[model samples]
Target: MRDAHYEWRCKAITPIWTGDAYQKNGRMIPSGLLGSVRWWFEVLVRGMGGPACDPTDPDSRCPDKHGNRCVVCELFGCTGWARRLQFKIVDSNGQPVQAAIVKDQEFVFHFTPLRPILDEEWALLDLTLRLIADYGAIGGRTVFKPSDERRRENMPQHKDYGLIEITSWPDIKVEERQLRSYLKQSHWRNMDHGDYAWASLDNFWCANGKHLARQNKDDSNFNRVLGRDERKTCKICGDIHDPPNKCPKNNRYPHRHSENLINKNRTNQWIAGDKQESKKVFSFRHPQRTFGFVNPEVIDFSEMKKRLRKAWPDLKDDEFHQGSDLLNDLIRSPGGAP
Candidate 1:
């Protein structure tokens, strides 16, 4: 495979990431652009049938360290493999970007290729780009998923869509030219160019559900529910849904005092919020464009309000709640009011 390079310009569609952990210079990007790229690469690999590993599962995310490395790790590099690529990021002014850490801020990145990639790796990298354009950020929050209830109603969840522009040497084959053309009018210049991006490199979007997790049984986000009491049965319906976190009733924060709304009125004995506290392990889901446990404290109060409205479309913008407050509303009341 011959060596070649490509360039990309992007804007943060959502607050890339939030929280003190990601605090830096004046912005936040998703665990650094490379980290986000790695995530997309993994997703592309799995989505293309490269491997069945879950992006959130470390054991599966990376290949066996000793001798068997997965296709993703081989190119993206992991403890088991050396990275097949290298990058150099900069602003439009041609100055290198700095990830100084800023809490709860939106960030973007403008990538100017610094090294030529082997021709074979181009396809995978192209696949990665498709994912970014189609999936936005990979781990904490995703771009194209509709809410469970919304989907059941036959609503197709459209991708929240991120802003991205790519320019490459014509001789080099690139993926999705139409997307790039729409992004920047197929602008091509013989000379080099540059731009700026602000993504919360240290934000928790990388860890919200899977990154924050320590285990996975090797399946979609649907089956990764956390288990606390394997033998416990739902008191209201006397049903046993394998993992205890499957209760549709328990909602929000620290996982304790998380109520089971199912038994709310029927038994007046709703899983005693705190009774199952010590014995319950909470299952976390992939947060769609909406933010969940990705460091809410560091997220801008105003932005939090905005994203909250989307998460709970039933609520008006003026009445949108933030943090756990919004979550509490998600658990329907005994009367069926959201």
Candidate 2:
């Protein structure tokens, strides 16, 4: 392990939820934070056209036939290989954090390299952290939303958990060409991933300058984007599929609702028939930003744009960013405003 390490100081804009197995929220869990970091890192790797495997799956996991692991597993670890970095959470005074769930509290992520960390990998991590601070949320309970009835009747107090602001981080830069070369060097980088609909930047989209209006009785923007409880009329039968039943006219199941399409389960019978996580990520608590990855084969760019427009009409064209454009901008200006 290297003697030197990297640290990122962050302030929780809202409550942060790195909870225990019972979902208790008193203490900070390093593994919870690490899992979120690894997830965003995998997304960025796929955005850069690199190979990243589903670590949770047994069939498609790392350490394949030739003992080779995907780029993510190489850094995050697998069954046989250990992670390249040791991670922990600390306070502003550099002491390990015990209790958590405090709002406006500053915390530091301490990352000590277990081996010689690559320049590209470091850059990717930097970008991932910045991306989370700017547009995404970390930890658990990110998908929590109050019921419509609660919104209308009670207006209960809710905290936007996982919203954080990056207060400080090390300056790191690596050329796009070097990153591409590193990805190209991986033997599995170009392998066919048609089966697994993993989140990739190639099919990613992000929008800013919009907030989820919880008080809106007609329809919440979160539900609009997530398609929660929203049913669509079956094209075949001209009947609204409330419970997502089969179409009587055609004897075929209706298309999946937005919720099902966005929050796909690994075992759900779908086109890919492989492990696929949620395609959409909405910073519900932090309403100014929303983003999601789409399977281009399922929902094209035009369709996604239309959906965003419908959900948040105020989203200007300039506020929207595709995966490739965002990646390029990050590479060009590593330290500039995101």
Candidate 3:
């Protein structure tokens, strides 16, 4: 009876934290505190390489603009990892070109000798790999048949196939030493390479259902990629998402701009055109991209102590009414010191 009833058991539900303050068994904690902790862990992984990569090195997207570029960001930008890697090369004659199969996706392969490829050539390979991975098998599609003639008749024709035929592949561990070496060599290059940088830098992607477009709520124009105006676009009011300025209506900006969709159905007094408030009726949000802003020097403990000393004539660090732990925690968090 127990064995039979086990199949009828309901799967446990994991409650999502929405960052609301709540009491858990009498101890107060934010509703999403667990998620917030997970988010911080991910940011640490993305900004500074996790234990796999060097934790001491800064991986935050909000790097010292003048300082080193992040290593975690670089690895993330290197294209997401694929489960089954395969490669193939087809010539103009639709025959397999004899070359080493260095790397492979479902249908495509990077040649061993590093075939001279222009940007267009790489794009063609990229597009072809996308199609094959979505549809075809690694080496090539095979159709089993009773006869040789039947097999030839049914098998999909392709130039040729090279097979690495990996089995029991180990997961690539984060290489902290390699990551450090890579960062040291390429730190200068990382400074200005954010044009193609993806959401791994900022948690902007979390605001959406992990959709790139949905995450970028400040973008006024959807089609433009590298345009100077590219920023996060808010869905509700259709305005660029910025910071430091509240919406004209003075509503508390949603934690993630994506949450504003919930407010869409609610009648907005700002939108209803209350004539007396018409001047303030038009609402706008801040842009997601950091505008041209100078970096202020990081305030160290000694500097903080000096300022506090002047204010209190002698207020000790621990004697302050509020704990400095919260401020210190914010400083260490990935979004980078507030």
Candidate 4:
């Protein structure tokens, strides 16, 4: 680890509930932990263009081509490729850690590189370590908001973020460290992060979004991402709405300019005498997250855009940025370090 020709070893300690449950040797194994961490890593150096695979799909293997595997397979592994790094889940005593049940348990693991960790790889590892520390979850069903949450039951949603312990990491700089920390554990996953919607039930960001522009008879007033808040806007009205203002349209949908962060009672339908039922709706609703559900759910970016329109419409936008645009800027910005 400290030398170039010898292998390097690092340790990770879980601070909250994790969903990595690869059952092997009578213990819950976490074979994909490295791979998961590598994803966030790839997003950092390579920008957004990576493999188009489902990512979480077990069958999602890198295509055999000249660079289809990208940074992931090069650091990890794939068919006809040997993993540059290897890891084993173990206990605090440094023995292989085991879990009889998936939830309510904790484990530790050691990451060892087959060779000296490259500077780029170290950059990835360093960024990931700091992220998990602040965001608060790992493996699956990880990431707790409010930063101080002690359990997954207290978290509003399970995300790609988590809290892990590693002591030997080198110093790095990130100006958006606080924001990235929030993003790693953010509820943005409840919104659409891609083009296709996952389970519609998990789309809670739509609950607070009651803007009638999308359902208004004037087809020109649909929502668009604009402004500092990166919130929604009425393309027809050309005016920013906020603080839960009501739209003048009689489309049965009430436009609440301000987004509701924790209201589970908000509905996607406006009950103005059942007139908006067939409203070509794409709004999300807030329902209680099913307790003890560990598997991650995927949501599309359209729903996310809706939520952004309601919360912060004036945020900046670039030509290409997945999920949140400011997030893309954060990665490229120089002041994000703690």
Candidate 5:
């Protein structure tokens, strides 16, 4: 069987962290980068109004009652199915990368098809990589929050990780209709209500030239936007304490509204040590950019913009790009525009 293979040369703009199971950084893990690619691919699928199952959730994963899979599952695979693409990272000399942290290095992403890959699938993958190179980030630790621990330390301004430039790519042309038709296939449809949020293009929002501010004494614009824990004070004694826990002086708790972007409910999930997973808003410090999808059920576009502007006064109206608008602008094919 003839296998479809493609390669792209990439340069890491910042440090790339593809850590091991122990969360130790300093080595290249192909699976780590593949996972990030899959994530962005899933986001793109959902943004384009295609079905993509949450692979992490057993109930929402692929191989449904009819043995059908979502568009993402068909290519990336899930339980009971193997991925169609084999991914690898090699240095400029075509040697396997030995470094843990991929910083300022030129590497190549080698993708070999394990099965007969379709043109639409290749187009989708190409689009995803291009998006990451242009406006988004890749790999892990892209959303590093310096305010958490290094706020008081005299450290240099934190640079964004996972930023890469695609220096070269194989010549492959696919029409927009091909992708649309492929997504419309019956086998790629799955109807499952999962807890994981689907990042649709209609709900996506992004901006450049604005980033989280570094720590300035106790003031950090970025931290303020992300939100800080405000301990509730005892109503009687005026002592601070976490909710549901009694204060030193009094048993009664104070009733106050939270001003955090990530509320109490989401903050509690961070106890599992995956703070990035719990956050909805993602920012890059060096590029001065932020991008995230909003749950329209929770907040509308105007309201979300208002809240962000409240924290970032320098942000202008012209700087923001709605997901739908970006799709139309970035995609070249006629049918690519939504």
Candidate 6:
């Protein structure tokens, strides 16, 4: 019987073979598509025999969050490998800009130690590596910009710093322009912008309307804007948008509202409205809330760190710090993390 530790370790590290059957010691272990069907058959056979698996208990021996034990997802959820991609960008003083950078300049660059192949094995191997950094936005947007307070204090501005597209890997197939636009539009949900994440996802789904924008070059902006008529009001903020456009301050795409744009007073009011309100609106519109899955399984940091230490048995604390700083610099662009 496999113990919890054994099962966990196997699930964590092994890339379950998505291939055909292989005979090992004259015992045929089905794999790939056939294996999937066979596993289902065996489960049915087991359930019929007497000892039944509980369908309600998620933490039970079920392989999936749905308690259906999806072997494929159990082996590989939406989880991705964390890799340390180093960028050696030097300032005029020859000092490295050591900080985590994200989506730098809208391009993607593929990096591997000694040029590692981007095969199934490398991907699974990379997942076991510890992530030195993660990226997100400030004021509830993915795009980062220094706040007024930070700017007043003369703090560094944070922005995306990864390449827009990784040209080397054709398999990755990133659309630089599309991603940049998606990210930029996604920023509108930020407090500094207008907190438009809720609807922004529709505009930027699958990296921004891939079907329409990418293929048809559709220029029709899909964001909801208050026309001359629309019955709606902000419940939490108590700001109303009753025609003559009551809540122009909270409008997602206020610039599109030409009537509201005409008045300097309205502009100043929105410009000066509680910054917290802006944050609320941003949070309300955040793409992550709409798109993020519930109870997502995270890469176990404890195991990952343990693996890292084991792999580099002689690595110093400063080396780890330096690696972290380098990774950060690679992700955070000049504007800084938002």
Best by TM-score: 5
Cα RMSDs, all models = 18.4, 7.0, 24.5, 15.3, 6.0, 24.0
Q: Which stretches of model 4 miss by more than 4 angstroms?
A: 1-27, 45-61, 91-93, 100-109, 143-162, 165-338
TM-scores, all candidates, are: 0.40, 0.79, 0.19, 0.41, 0.80, 0.20
Full-model lDDT for every candidate: 0.35, 0.69, 0.25, 0.36, 0.69, 0.23
How many clashes does the backbone of model 5 have?
3
52-86 in candidate 5: lDDT tens per residue? Answer: 88778777878887888898888898878899988
- Residue 230 Cα positional deviation in candidate 1, in Å, after optimal superposition: 27
lDDT of 2: 0.69
Worst 10 residues of 3 by lDDT: 1-10
Q: lDDT (0-100) at residue 171 of candidate 4?
A: 42
Report the Cα lDDT for residue 163, model 5.
83
CA deviation > 4 Å runs, candidate 6: 1-97, 102-163, 170-338
Question: RMSD of candidate 1 to the true fold?
Answer: 18.4
Model 5 regions more than 4 Å off:
146-159, 227-277, 333-338
lDDT of 2 by residue, 148-237 (tens): 335333232344578788888877767677777887684653345554554776766777655553443344555555445343346565
lDDT by residue (19-78, candidate 1, tens digit) is 134442244343455766775554444333343233355544445443555555555566
Give the per-residue Cα lDDT of candidate 5 at 225.
51
In angstroms, give how far residue 237 of model 6 lies from its true place: 12
CA displacement after TM-score superposition, residue 269 of candidate 6 (Å): 28
lDDT of 4 at 52: 28
RMSD in angstroms between candidate 4 and the native structure over all alpha carbons:
15.3
* CA lDDT for candidate 6: 0.23
List ranges where model 3 is wrong by over 4 Å: 1-108, 113-175, 190-198, 201-338
- Tens-digit lDDT track for model 6 on 12-61? 11011222234111211222222232222222222112111222234433
TM-score of 6: 0.20
Model 1 Cα displacement at 250 (Å)? 21
